[model samples]
Target: MKTSFVSNLAIQSAMRLTIQQTQAELLKRSQEQTTGIHYDLGLTLGATTSRSLNLQRELDRMSAMKSTNAVVTQRLSASQGALETMQKAAEKVRDTLVTYKGNDGVDAMKILKTEVNGALQIFTSAANTSFNGEFLFSGINTDVKPLAEYNSVPPSAAKAAFDTALTNYMSANSLTDMSQFTPAQMQDFISNTLEPMFTGPGWDANWSDASSQNMTSRISASEVIESSTNANTKSFRMFALASVISSELMDKNVNSQVRNTISNAAFGYVEQAIAGLNGERSSLGISESRVKKATTSLEAQQKLLNTHILDINGIDQIETATRVNTLKTQLDTSYALTSRLQQMSLLNYL
Candidate 1:
């Protein structure tokens, strides 16, 4: 019943299959040892494959978020620095005006005007600060400059409005002395003309390069934060109005009465601006802290995800190497045995 001999073709085929299987095992072991990761995830985590895959996807998404957050942190840091510099310039201007309020000396006034102009220029440059080619103070209009030049050859809309009001006041009263105008008239001009010029449609016409909608970025799964500032903010407008008043008062053609009115207004505006600037600083500081905190938390999350992923897919190098070595030895021994068997003739069995 068992007299059938094994054919040469069958023996060859079995040997080939065995060799192929050994080679495949060797390759897998080598790969696992080199990479410290299993080649076949399904084989490594058969029952938990779906869970592991979801975790991997989460890890990938978190990695992308971390990368984006780094850029956001840089921009926020830069913005904070620029705003600090801007606030300092405004403070200096305010202090200087307060210190020399009643001094009408040519030399003293000249020095004050020079300082005001310098501070204004510094503030203007800060307002136009950029990071990675995007304007920081432009709100959603990242590509547009947030402010026109402080002494633009063609006056800004706000400045033109002020000029027109001044001309009308002089023409209507037939008065050379702006002092002739009562306190009520001066108040009316400021309320109806200058203040309104920095808000609503006037704000859009004068300085805003930004939309009302701010730029926002997701800092976490459930959290988003504003990533932009704008020239139209009340704090920025207050500083701008103060600067314009100081610059105009420096004109020698303007009388002492006009200069006094402008100086008093400028002083009040500067004081108010300091308070507004403090609020702006407070808000920005809070946002910066949040960004830093989010970054730290995200980094911790990513580290945990990496550890979890490794737990699921990582192979032990020592064990994998040992398995490879055993396979190689087995394959070599099989080849040697096969060769010996081939050499043995049927006559040897007699």
Candidate 2:
């Protein structure tokens, strides 16, 4: 009987230790959830959170790209509006020269010349347009103004330089009709315009990537009109019409025709700029669409990953509570059994 009691006592002690160890493990897991990886709980919550952070960062980058695109779009929209106004003026100039072909009037010619000079200034301003401190039409030369100013030079000198430049542009293309345009056509225009100034050459690297912010920025400064898209906000056909009109006025001894012709040519450059702007708009649209799609898809993926991470690491409080209560009951039973064994000595058992 004494041997049996000793043996039972040994078993009771071992069983209590086992119960305590099990409770300790439960407590450790709980702590891990609360304290992250460094805590005694040793839960996967910290790892899950880390993954979530990485996804969030990528989302943030995509969001920033979208914001950048929005700004560029707005700027382009404003530029297009300006181009439209300039085109109307160019058409009017053409009509005037056509009107003055036989009508001899000094006062009328003076008025037309004034309007033409005003148009010239407007178009030059457009070419020199800037956004946030960088020139929009200067290609890669953001700081350098694309249109030259000749306030210090005499009117004839200015006209001579301007006409020479235009003639150079026309001759450089050897392109009689501004109908079809490709990447090569555009590059040829740029080369023709910049080549005279630089013996070396135009920088072909200005638009190396589709995502080039600078490329989009230089949209409205083409040297000549290829199509209506390239047509000055006014239109190349319209500019040619104006030139014909100006020549008619010159034939009729209208003094304003010469100045008006020069002004019309400059503004015509503004008209062709529309094509470049449209190209940029198209590019921006594609970029924006891609960014939005990518962002949305990435967000969805991130959300799913987050859900997975939660499942891996998150605890069900209700379930845990139930478990804890059950463990407590078992522990209490063990303690009670231990007490019974300790108290029930051989003498007491009798």
Candidate 3:
């Protein structure tokens, strides 16, 4: 064939382009083999872009849930510890009071008084407990301390009223002996006077915890959990009443009959308090277990989502290696051809 100048130049340009294209292909495949993910994800995941993006978004949400759940779990754990400690203190006082019931010894009452005071302090301190600057027992009022300090100077108005009523009632009745007081009279004093102080307007006035509302956290797409407990529950009320009555019983000015009646009341209240505490602990335990299970499930889902994303965009190592070798051979062949064509000329052909 008699090749024209323009035709020969066009052939050489086409050969050079072919060699460059093959070299680029070799580089791409080599990178794919080394990285496993495609060098050009947009091209590799062309049709599946939407699916992969959705999966990634879901995974991100799951990760975020895990992080928040960790914080919730920590707070719940701290609350649980405080509850258990308070429970133990209440139980110890209950056992001692029961042991010394009806003894009426001045020395014994003194010891029991000390124990009751200690239990009260423990319950109050636990109620005011905080985790990471948030009050654990304040329900949604995380920023507020849940309980008043047990012995505030000058006394709370409610405490002052309580102190005066018990003293005046004892003096007005002219009953110096606790045996003169009936359980019904003590019940009247408690229901009409003291219980209201712990559970009704006085409690609301002094404490910062919400009435019954629990804090909730959403740990997954389908799961929401009560992440906090409040201080105004029946358990706390029972504990408060028991602690207060026991403290009252310790007053030597109160007749033995009054002390005995108060001790009996304290016994009943402490027993009920223990039962209530157990129930609260069980409920919180179940909540914790559910949160943990949800966390584990979310983690597993996140792993699966990552796998699916890799499936959409990841390269097969074996296939990438084979393609790299093949592209290298093609580029080598193209280079050899281009070099030979470069060396060739009309003079050589002639």
- Models 1 onward score TM values of 0.84, 0.44, 0.78
lDDT for each residue of candidate 1 in 131-229, tens digit (9 for 90 to 100): 999988888889998887657677766667667767886687675765466555565666567777776577777676666667788887777888766
Candidate 3 residue pairs in clash (backbone atoms < 3 Å): 177-257, 178-256, 178-257, 178-258, 179-257
Alpha-carbon lDDT, every model: 0.78, 0.46, 0.79
- The TM-score measured for candidate 3 stands at 0.78
Return the candidate ranking by lDDT, descending: 3, 1, 2
| lDDT for each residue of candidate 2 in 33-148, tens digit (9 for 90 to 100) | 45432232234344566665565565465456446545655555554555555555555554554554434466765666565556545545554566778555554555655444
Q: Which is better, 2 or 3, measured by TM-score?
A: 3
Q: Which candidate is the best by lDDT?
A: 3
- Candidate 1 differs from the real structure by a C-alpha RMSD in angstroms, to one decimal, of 4.1
RMSD of each predicted structure = 4.1, 13.1, 5.2
Q: What is the per-residue lDDT of model 3 for residues 1-350, given as tens digits with 9 covering 90 to 100?
A: 78755666677899889888888888888888877788887776787877877887888889999999899899889989989988997897798788877777878878888888887888888878899998888888888877765556878654676677777776777757655666666767876778777767677766445546878999789988898888888888888778877776555545566567777778888898899888878878888998899999998888888888888878889888888888888888878877877887789878
lDDT (Cα, 0-100) at 82 in candidate 1: 84
Point to the candidate with the largest TM-score: 1
